[model samples]
Target: MSSRLARTSALTVAAVCGSALLVMTAVSASGNTAEEPRLHDIQGKTRISPFAGKQVTDVPGVVTAVRGFGKARGFWLQDPKPDDDPATSEGIFVFTGEKTPDVEAGDSIRISGEVAEFYPGGEEAGGQSVTQLTGAEWKAASKKKAKLPKAVGLGADRVPDAYAPEGKGDEGNIESLKLQPRKFALDLYESLEGMRAGLRNAPVTGPSTEFGELWVTADPGENPTPRGGTLYGAYDQHNGARMKVSSLLPREENHFPKADVGDELRGATTGPLDYDNFGGYTVRATAMGELKDNKLKRERTRKQSKDELSVATYNVENLSPESEPAKFERLSEALVKNLASPDIVALEEVQDDSGPQDDGTVAAGKTLKTLTDAIEKAGGPAYESRQIDPEDNADGGQPGGNIRVAFLYNPDRVDFTDRKGGDATTPVKVGDDGGKPKLSANPGRIEPQEEAWKESRKPLAGEFTFKGRQVFVVANHFSSKGGDQPMEGRFQPPVRESEKQRTAQAKLVNSFAKKVEAIDKDAAVIAAGDFNDFPFSPSLDAIREGGVLTSPMDELPADERYGYVFNGNSQVLDHAVTSPGVGPVKYDIVHINAEFHDQASDHDPSVVRMKP
Candidate 1:
């Protein structure tokens, strides 16, 4: 499966195919007068072209690269004679429809076409538009081959520290803003859009994705995490160094490198800088780089001590009985070997037995059984499952999959406290048992009817006992970042509209945990799962406020805080936090799945070892 950014590329394909009208405008040689604008004149200084929507005759440039395959067939053209301005790019893309453009890289051409700002996935997509000359008709200006323009070097010295210009809130776009290439990275990229760009020995920040793409950083020192991936600490710190790299060569012929984090794209990787919806700015490589592996290895956390209770959170990405046996085996192996068989595991995306089939089967008994059976087979303890199944199709996920959070506890290590009467809509409550806090409904949903959890998974609160002491754990699969605008979108400091729901969810989780603490100040309450927002995000801030619970990420080293990688940035989406009652926990965010191309789930499981 591809990352969220890559998944949006499919929408871009449709956008490109629809723009293939190729309107051949017939005028006269008067259209080819000396007053014809150059490539930079059409590009202008801002993101949106000045000549947009106007039919211009004989725009001159040489073909730099050709994308012959796919529905959005096009060629990049570069003017050999460039202007002094750094804001206006000398190169631009010429969009040809279904047929490949009859032009070679060396040929100098003068094209007549309408300058159009083509949004890759439509204007409503909230992404930056690609300025192209569509319906283009051209003639060879010179038979003599011209040398390609020198690729502008995008090394550490050139890329800016700042990311983008501030978004014009009500206006919604930065298209009209003048380019400040030296001050902001986004502006720098916009200034050089559709132009020849190069990266030398670029450090791989994100692993090679399934969509034949990878993320690399030109600036080596831009918030470099200890694990080689770039750090995305906050919204304010959008790392300017990150750039997506895709090959211009056709899929069947091109051999994109398979690389992990810490690897290097050896030598100079030259390409025409293009903007797309998938990844904000991309380098469509004409000369691809060689992979230089740094031998980055997967990590394993130390096992929990005998007296300590080990709890782990893993999103077994939509696992069901219909899933491949290999997936079960891999997940089981990771649980047993990598995590050292934690006493309690909070699993997210536990699908129904029938998987994606919309047959109204909501129970995940078979799915849990299959996973537990695999764990036992993989030399782990025999685990028991606890979960409150949601109403049919009420939760949002794969149509009939009905994914929900479930707990897997080793019977030999811990005992599950089973309180009856837990159902889909019933809210879990903290009840006073003498002087201690007790769960009113063990394995119960936390405010399932709340508006914050409209189509999202309800938080599952389960009570367990380890060594005669009662322990409370709330497993959550919060609302995803589905509808949020891309970080590289037209709106600078792209708006995270999905954050509101997540923040609301976080407050609810915080309230529930606080109640457990209020009943007993020393209650060992833990909340963990896929929050689906960064640790520095407002959602996380809401959870950490008022000194109720402390995130284990605070104890972790700055560089080792991430459990998931997205768009090449190592960020924390899955997290675990403990009430003040739980003291001195050793936390580990295992690096197994997110870094490797072959993986059981996209998120890496995190383990917290503490004496409850």
Candidate 2:
């Protein structure tokens, strides 16, 4: 007999001849069959089980996995006779108490339980609802271990084309959508939730570090980023292409394999699909393959030419005097060794000396001093810093932090043309200086009190002369996307409410750049900082609306454009936009951070070199 037939025959024999297999009791005195139904009847045809709220009985399956120690004590079981439809999953979690289950893997048993939809990490966390069998009672049908089901291979061919549905109404309602397993990846994963699946020869897109999780994509990924991972598109297009591997076994026994980008998980990784608080759908690995590191290295940019000027932008993630001394030391190394010490660097999230202490101290002299001193100690140039401190707690970061944008320039390479110092309330105007655009205040705030900048970091504009050429620089740290919906959230085409403020801020900065061009048509202008939005986003478009400033990142190859990674996708959040007439430019995104476990900052810095 064929293997399929043999398995079918064995299941039939167990069902017909097994002891007490046909017994069923009503959950209450009502004697209602609906109250206690078969596992197949409970599974039904949709993502959620049909008998979800009702008690179920005589649900027969083989034990697949057991989690006896965690806060969520459970074991997963899969039915031998699965329905032909792909939408409904045959496997279901049995929520045992803190006590361990009196069962082992490969044991064919009949269970009496309540069918429930357990939402992990509570409902408010936007966690996925997992259908499970709770308050369960089971009795073994066969002591003889039956052969386990073959692992469902999740190869590239099995991956769906689209990541999620297009419309909003059905985005979070995964249970209601019609399953198109072959067309959409989200649909495919939703169909297979709580089922045994396997990945063969998958590439590790993200390594397990602090979270003990590994993100993998099928080899030769679709919509691959320059760094070998997938790109998160506008409409959550890459959500289905990546999967997180999590192990439920003891940490020592299931130590997550350490591998970087381009590494492969060879052989076979088999696990039961689950949805948790982290990445949406995770595979709790019961078996893992060998991890092979591809030996990825942190790449350094080409050194700046003597005649050319190099500028860089870095978001230090709320750096202050009170921050760990080691963080400052590591950041200095990244600036000197990795970035090669650019002529001018725009810094974001530089906090006051007292850091998050809300005592109304807005000055950051001590904070900047610590950083500049560290850079100089690391063999970098002695950089001079300039910034306008915002009102305490007015900026929307950590309270009392007074986080704002600032500039660090190598005094030996550039000259800060100090015109007039502008305070927090000053409105720096774009004026005509002999037909060249001139800033009324050399280092001034750009519409600091504007409604768009309400409780946000104001853009800092400064003028500098390098190689006898005057260059305009506007350092910006726009309103963050804190209010925006998560990319993996229930909302389809997630709402980015913060984009409005960013757009307004971008228009204001664009106006300054245009004013500079109006003064000197061919003048070099650089606007660089943590934009807090993607290069292709609408906010960035607002900055380039007048065609005065353009993203040099766009000139880079598609794969090399990203300076940030979110949800396993390499994307650009920090950017530099240069004036139209700049020539012979070279841009590099130094990947010193973002990908590593020991990163000093969450963002990677980008450097640009061009003739002024």
* Top candidate, metric TM-score: 1
Candidate 2 lDDT by residue in tens digits, 461-516: 98888998888888989898876655553444556778999999999999878877
In model 1, what is the error at residue 493, expressed in angstroms? 2.9
- Cα lDDT of candidate 2 equals 0.76
Report the error of model 1 at residue 460, Å.
0.4
lDDT for each candidate structure? 0.85, 0.76
Per-residue lDDT over 432-485 for candidate 1, one digit per residue giving the tens place of the 0 to 100 score: 888888777888899999999998999999888999888888899999998788
- Pairs clashing in candidate 2? 226-559, 435-519, 436-519, 436-520, 437-519
The top-ranked prediction according to lDDT is 1
- In candidate 1, position 509 carries an lDDT of 91
Please identify model 2 stretches exceeding 4 Å from their true place: 1-34, 38-44, 68-73, 95-128, 134-148, 168-174, 225-227, 233-239, 356-361, 419-421, 486-490, 581-584
Cα shift from native, residue 533, model 1 (Å):
1.3
